[model samples]
Target: MAGVGVKDLLSADDIDESDLFDVLSKAAAIADGKLPARTRPRMIGLFFEQESTRTRIGFDVAASRLRHHIVDISASPGSRLGKAQGEDLEDHIRTISEYCDLIVARTEHVATVEEIARLTHLPVVNGGNGIGEHPTQALVDLFTIERRLGDVRGLSVALSCDPTARHALSFMKLLALRPPRRFTLCLAPETKLSNVAAAAIDDLRRCGTIIDRVDNVEATLDHDVLSIQTQRASSIISGRIGEMDTAQKIEDEKFTLTAEKVLRNRSKTMIMNPLPRHSETDKSCDSLPNAAYFDQVRLSVPIRMAVLSRMLAGRRWAGRSPSRSQPGWPETSSPISSSLSRSVN
Candidate 1:
């Protein structure tokens, strides 16, 4: 139980295949309402430096459903992080770890998150660290793939986007552990795979997973799964690289995913996106059967729940066992008698 509390989900490499599968299985049960909800007073602290709609809301909702009070800390300009406050990153983490049961950190530097994990005693969840790794999002992606395809290891998966995006890089590393049979990366000439991404490719090859790169969309068309990420939007919007901001837009004719592309797959290919999508995916594909990007968002809640629950590994709280089907509980409604009356009729 002591070692089960994952301090940092930096890469897929952080979690072995068996552990990854177990967490995902539990997450699925929680999502489907098959498991009894836990009531724990454990407070989780959330720290986000970047703009996030899905990851932020998902953790908030998941923790609330599990009856955990959340303490939020942001890394915006007004916060202590921007002022170069009284303490360094490690000192702040060590200080905060004493106050909160767990820390969910989202920062611009992967090294900062790793340093925090190294220094803190409490569990640290990498919400997203720069272009480093986003293990939880990858978990949600794997969960969605499991639900739709029933298997992940034998499938052909394609990653399309800027290779430098940490999320994509992290995902490739994770895929290496599971070892997808045929893994293809679709990228532009300027977007060669980063050193981290290249190492992941090497790992994939060593594990007997076929790996390739193509600049053309048609080359990526054959894969059974597609994971499209738009993390570059944040980079471009911030104008980090000179004044260039319009690179986020993929030409409608070049990299767009429409209904026609969905129909082209010989076998129905599941489409995934980390969301906040740009011009890469057209609005028309939203209704397609193979479109699972929104499903990826929906899966985040249970995965967050699983993460929170795992953090409370050793502590024995007055939570109902996950085994019971009807862990009868009352909502914010009237007394049990009145609640039963509505159902009786």
Candidate 2:
């Protein structure tokens, strides 16, 4: 058994820039079918406590591609093995760990996944943890950005969503660790940065990331990358029938990414949505060249395959030397470079 240095991928804070880049590179190779197949079969457990489509399917496909047998364990509140059924989470995790080589868990609370990691000797991958962090999503998002835009450093990235969204927080946390020189992060009006996020923002600033809080969605559109996160309160629901009404009510046109806006800045900006989108992103914009949101979904398999392979193989990343000099921005610079440059100071 190869010992991948890290035991589990519970948070974005668990990985650094070098490891991130290396995984992405490996992902590209995996997508191209260049990587060799697994020598032996492994059993992977998919333990989802919340409703999901993308993350679950992506992991399932990734595991299958790597020749791993997947055992799906759905433990939603009302299900047979759910907490409501009198099953203890720790006991469930321990039992699952004994049968599976790896466990990918999505739960209602961050502490749930944390406890899963604590109790299990087997490696745990956080699929999505309540309002905490979705490290895998962040990895796929970064990979998509780098693939489409060429690089992540020095690009202006606007994360428009409710401040408490876990995916947004995880993305920001990852960026903070390996901040780009002269990078910009634009926050939506409703976003209230958590204390931890605020500290990360401070670190980004010190590392030369220009941070901006904007009221209008249009204000964020002029940047190099636009990432929209759908509001979670409206998205997560308990009952099946009542969810449609709630989802409809939460679709706000004000935050919608319209075709008109995409046309105006299509050449300069890349549009991204961490999916299951409501009215936040217009369907018409899907056909546009700069729309990388769907591509993010397409790339998730390879990215996840790379992640699982590394964790299972115990591969370690060679770290990069710290640099104080400003990194060069990508050749395809944003049109509003002058204004963006001023915002950095």
Candidate 3:
């Protein structure tokens, strides 16, 4: 599987629609055990300044399955990232540049990943960065969307989430690329969308995606997919929810979904979440056939394998670093990027 253009997977916007579909296709190939073998194994670094559950384990297993070695450095003391060790990011990156072929970083600030990119020519992947983006998770979600719905084209989607959350923002950014026929935001009453969130939805409209914002979750009942998540106090403390970093939660029951609610709607809308869910999704909802969140986890390995495999293409740190413009994953060799990667106007 080849990569989508852009030097690093720092933001969802770095790759366009074709790049997303390409990675999804590669995931399918890897699942079927048809992935081509690499000439040699390389070391992959997973540096996390923030705590994680799924993403960390998922990438670790994916890297192992592909036969490469993994070098994990977490915020246990922040020493690996140089925070606890009284070292700056540049010094730490320089140390790892010699040992790793690629780096996957999760930071409290998106700027950290951008900084790592600037410090070295090595390929970098954003595990999760502030409220900015979790590009890989967004890609995994797109894969699940297609699996359940058959396709993304012309489908209606509704998102009920903390609009400023990293995972949510990345998902919206990616959805913009595929251009759903209609995109809806089912927000709780009084909950507000951030300026950056509004800008992202506007990008979808640029691709002809019809947009709507409703105060009720049921309003999303007719959409082909409903992606749900919310911000809570823990999120504020971690600073993953937004810049305000203030305590907040969308507690309105009207915004939450239950098994009975799904049964009542009976609209074939698939339910999803980037989980460790909250009150918004009742435990009862897990029993419903429409629950694809867990299945989303099931697809994580291959989605990640596809990403790791592609990002490692033509990458090595031992050799003299190449220009950042010359990406490890070859740019789309056709007109797909130029035609589909336009920025929001």
Candidate 1 error regions (>4 Å): 1-6, 36-39, 75-91, 230-234, 237-248, 264-267, 314-345
* Steric overlap count per candidate: 1, 2, 0
lDDT score for residue 83 of model 3: 49
**Candidate order by lDDT, highest to lowest?**
3, 2, 1
TM-score of each: 0.81, 0.83, 0.83
Q: What is the lDDT of candidate 1?
A: 0.68
- Which pairs of residues have clashing backbones in candidate 2? 3-314, 4-314
Identify the superior model by TM-score, candidate 1 or candidate 2: 2
TM-score of 2: 0.83
What range of 10 consecutive residues in model 1 has the weakest lDDT sum?
323-332
Cα distance off (Å), candidate 1, residue 104: 0.5
Residue-by-residue lDDT tens digits, candidate 3, 196-314: 56667777878898777776788788889999876452365265557552333545777788888888978688999987676778888888888899988878889988888877884
lDDT of 3: 0.73
Residue-level lDDT for 16 in candidate 2: 77
lDDT of the candidates, in the order given: 0.68, 0.70, 0.73
- Candidate 2 residue lDDT tens string, 277-318: 777777888887778888999999999999889877766433
- How far is each candidate from the true structure, as Cα RMSD in Å? 15.0, 7.6, 7.9
